[model samples]
Target chain A: MNHVIEIDGLTKDYGEGRGVFDVNLTVEPGEIFGLVGINGSGKTTTIRHLMGYLRPQKGTCSIEGRNCWKHAAELKKHIGHVPGEISFPDVRTGMDFFNLQARYLGIRDKTRVNSLIDRFNLDASAPLKRMSKGMKQKTAIVAGFMADAPILLLDEGTTGLDPLMQKVFTELVQEEKAQGRTMFMSSHMFDELEATCDRVAFLKEGRIIDVVDMSLLGGNEPVKEYKVEFTSDEDYQTFLAQSFLVKRHRDDYKQVSVLLSDRDLNALFASLSGLDVRYITQVPRTLEDQFKEKYQESEGTNHAY
Target chain B: MPINSALLRQTTRENVTLWGVLTAVQCLLVGVIGMTAPIAAAGIAYYNMLPGIFMGVYAITVGNKLISSQVDRGTLAYVLSNPVKRSTVIVTQVVFFAGSLLAMCTLSAVAHSLGAYFSTFGANSAEIQTIFKLNLGLFTLALSFAGIVFAASCLFNLSKYTIAVGGGIVCAFLLFPIMAMFGSKFAFLSNLTVVSLYKVGSIMASGTGWAWDLVILAAIGLVAFAAGGVAFVRRDLPL
Candidate 1:
């Protein structure tokens, strides 16, 4: 499959259901993959395995066909990483850190660094220990993206950035994506994942629930969902008796959510004609909604899998 | 070597201020006391006890902060993310630390020589040689102490545990000698500490046994540092 990053049965058991279990994943070249999970759900654990910071207990993680643990130093040359926690060294200022990193990474070009600083509006002259949380995050972002490596790994990539800065960061990521750079990122914000990821994996209780292709959720002719509240009780009953699929309903508010394919718009309009409707609004079926559905479905099965 | 260069520079810059203060205190102690007290007594107090204690403190600080503290605070991930081997990081720290100790010891020796010349009203070659031998003993002792704490740093993931065990052993090494000075009963305790390997009075009296002292001290240092390297390479970092 020409996978740039591969994990086969990677398991690290900290005991008491606290670690990743048999996580198998493959990220193809130039693919933007996203890992979505709440805190302590093994997202960071999986990323640390990929970074070679933690050794797997059972299986192997590799990058470009080299074992992550055995050839970590060599593999690092091809990877740029932004850790979940931002902790700078004892360097006096951000510029000092950047220069140190440049020398360590053997990067002779400083132009990329200066441009990243300008794009993020970062103050590289300020002392690292004294910088605010947002500034520290921005500095880490600049450092990670400046090298322009073919493969990038970011854990909670935009946690502390303000809305405007988050927009800038996502724009930078999109540009990297457009250049065919392979990326694996984890985030708490579903919108960020939906905006940049080709495929997103949901992790729950240290297990991967599913990996969803964004295209499958309706690419060009995406399915549309709507919530309509009929003004009259009789109209609401009549609409409920129709053949349209009612995904959810609120009896008190006389509102029902209906899922329809893009081609079914005319049929939907015809079905609603001459009906006393109070209001109708489109319901965006986001990554969060998918995540919630997966969780609910899993619970409903009662360990059927 | 390139990977180590940047790390060395950063460590040196962060450590210079505290090192400067230690150096000034050391130079002043040997330079001032050597002019007033008997040369032998001055060497024992300023050269043997004072610098030994200071070096012990410095060794523990470097040993703990250089690796374990960074790991505990999650900062080591940044350094390891670069194209640097784990072995390279530990080796670079040991080299930088040993060089700093050697420089401080040499400066102490120079300060001691200056004091001895003024006290004797002439340049006493014999006293200067005695100071040089004593400084060598102190440097090796310092190296041994550093290796011990550094090994502790490598064996543990948490800085608190490293500091507790490493700092406790160093404290005992420092205290045993001070207590031994009171009487003969406590003198046996000195043999249990590295400070006993540095026989300042006996070395100055005979002038020929300093070779064996250096060898033993070097042996202690090499063994401890090698053990530390193995532990660090084999250990799994939680970051």
Candidate 2:
């Protein structure tokens, strides 16, 4: 796969208190790559470096084989960037901004611009200051899409959007993916990412703790969650003691839910051959669960966010 | 050329509302001031009142806002993210602003020349030339102020700090000459300020002093622009 963005040992320090440390990551061409992390995880910093808004203090970040800082204008031609905050001059209407951006990007497609306006449901006549957060976000997104650049760098693109707009955005991203455009998105929302991104890199304190390929994780053997209803309390206790499955939750003496991997499930069935078995229901691991596990393992602590 | 025009169009479009209102207010103030004192009226007609007023306001208003607005509106990140070089952006902004100021100054000079010709005590050819020189000197002063402020704005990211430093620098330039007049020993101090250039222009329509002032202004403007470009190129923008 062609790598669209390649970052190696990128470091940025804002005084002594804040900034990103040596960071490395890559986004392949035509892939929707997600950067997932909590607030202050250096997600935005990395995006800034990739977009050439910030020069890396050390190492290199390149887009399409061009070092972003050194070849910013050339790299910018191939990339469309959306900042975390969408702000424009209060005096300019949406149409004015669109016209300026279109002219700058050398776009002459009025139909495409109008189509984007319709897709995002933005009011072209309204001044930028009057638009709602979601509308502003849509404007920025439309502007990015209008550039028709091969790469899209979005920093927390869906933070302020409502659920409906978020869904629309996800669909729009999917559409872009279909067109073979590469998207590198930094978002705190795991569910939104799970819906669209092909792969995700989990960043923790400026370092990528895990990079999960969604396809591989989703293709892993489906682990079935079974809550065996025992006839007697003693039988339940005996079965629980013998079972090697990871206990997820326990409600009562006779009621317990445990997560079982494929091998554990097979062993569980073989062991409970004679006992009355309860109905078995399959529960697949979500991206959130996988992420939580990785985060916990990496940090050696459970953080509830 | 088209790209440059497009960028110029963007800057013009963004500033139209504010600059339009400011220009109107300045014209009104000049008219009102012209009516107050007869001698001052001759000064206005002969010395080109509009350019002086416009330059003063433009230096304080648009000059201060040029870079501060980018940081205030959070569009700096988006603009800097583009493929364009940092130096290109700085140069474009400086040239656009300086060109605009020059145009206004030239127009005001023409208007003053006409106003003097039609006034009760009309200005002669020499007076018209002197007014022209004063306007030119003022334009350079304003342009230099813009450059200095632009540099300050770039050096400091915070809008409040940029404004403070920019305003303080301009104020110092304006006040140093007045303060130097009080003490004979301190008279030389005025030579260090941009106000000295304006004084020389007012005294001599065509002289080596004005030429030196223009050169110094251009050099300072170039240095300010270069510093801003370097800072922008080197500093990491907050994402």
Candidate 3:
């Protein structure tokens, strides 16, 4: 199967150790691939390479089997992009901008543009200079998606959108996915990717640390975690001594969070039977938790986005 | 060169205001002087410095706005994201820059021509030819200034740097010739700048020698404009 977007050993060095290095990714046709990283983690840099705005110091990027840098102008016809930074050209209003883009794309039909304005709840008549951040983001979103291109490369597309609007954007992405449009989006928002992406890649210090299959995420895993607090220090020590996988331990609070498979549930209960416990509750693990763990594993520090 | 009509329209809309103001100012200055004073007396004063200053202002400001300002603002992403190539964009801007400057000079030439024709001290054919020639020389000079600035605009990613280098060069060119007027010792400074190529004294005296100078000016503009466009096409855009 041919990948809609393929990046091989992509590298861009900005000096002082501040650029993407040996990054590789491939998005299967029609798949929604997500890139999640903290600020300065090379998310934007990677997207810029795909956009052909910056030439990679090494390696190459291709979309629909054409080199991104070599065939940038031709390839862009089928790709919709929401840049990391949004800046409207010299135009009077949002409508003027949309119209200008339509001209560039040779889209004479006004119906698609008008429908997009209505869908985003944008005041197309409002001057671009007076627009709020959220409004500007909506305009960029509309521009990126309005063409109904077969592929989308969105770099932090929903920066200033409200929660409700982000939901609208998510629904739009899902709708586009249903129509078999390939999407490769980068975001700092974990839940957004979790909700829409088929697979997500984590980038750290300009290199991809991991690529996770959404199916292997905590929500679908049979291995559940339970946080248990003991009534006394002796019980806490006794519970810790039990060979269950200890995911977390708080000695001062007499709490131990243990991971247990469905088949091991009976064994966990038998072990706690003789112990005096204060309370036990299921502790849900999310992508955020996994990301934090991965981040700390590599950096040995608890910095998070 | 490929030129997108939409981009051309947008470029025109972005720059027409400054072009209009400067062209009108030039036409007014030339018209008033040619109509009110004798052609020979007003020729040196009007053609020598005022038009050059106006051209400098227009070229410096509009040249920066054409390329570097759009990139600096990141607005160019919208254009580049479309199917249009970077070559098409730079070419379209060059067309706008060259065309607008030509129009500005042509209109001012017509204004001065009519002003001289209708003046109480009616002009001869030689004087009328000098007026047209002087404006033609101004047009080439403006092109040269714009070309240098356009190249700077394409070479840099920021508008400030474009203005500092390109605009700075043009301002220096305009100032050098004026500074040389202070004394013969400073006259050598005039040769250092491109504006000296205009040779207003030669043009005003109906000498054919000024035509060759205009060719050099035109060549500079063409070379600079082409260099700017090629630079824009070859370099990486942050957009």
**Candidate with best lDDT:** 3
Q: Which stretches in model 1 have alpha-carbon errors above 4 Å? A: A218-239, A242-244, A250-256, A259-284, A301-305, B1-3, B124-126, B182-185
Q: TM-score, each model?
A: 0.91, 0.88, 0.92
lDDT of each: 0.87, 0.72, 0.90
Question: Between the candidate structures 1 and 2, which one is better when assessed by DockQ?
Answer: 1
User: Superposing all C-alpha atoms, what RMSD in Å does each candidate have to the true structure?
Assistant: 2.8, 3.7, 3.1
User: Which one is best on TM-score?
Assistant: 3
lDDT sort, best first: 3, 1, 2
- lDDT, candidate 3, B75-158, per-residue tens: 888888998888888889999998999999999988988888898998899888888888899999999999999999999999
Per residue, candidate 1 scores C-alpha lDDT tens digits across B80-175 of 888889999888888888888899889988987898788755447887888888888888999889888888988888999888988788889989
Residue-wise lDDT of candidate 1 within A154-230, one digit each (tens)?
Answer: 99999889999999988999999999999999987998888889999998877888898886653332677889999
Greater-lDDT candidate between 1 and 3: 3
- Listed for every candidate in order, the interface RMSD values in angstroms are 1.0, 2.1, 0.8
The candidate maximizing DockQ is 3
Candidate 3 lDDT for residue A61 = 95
- TM-score of candidate 1 restricted to chain B? 0.93
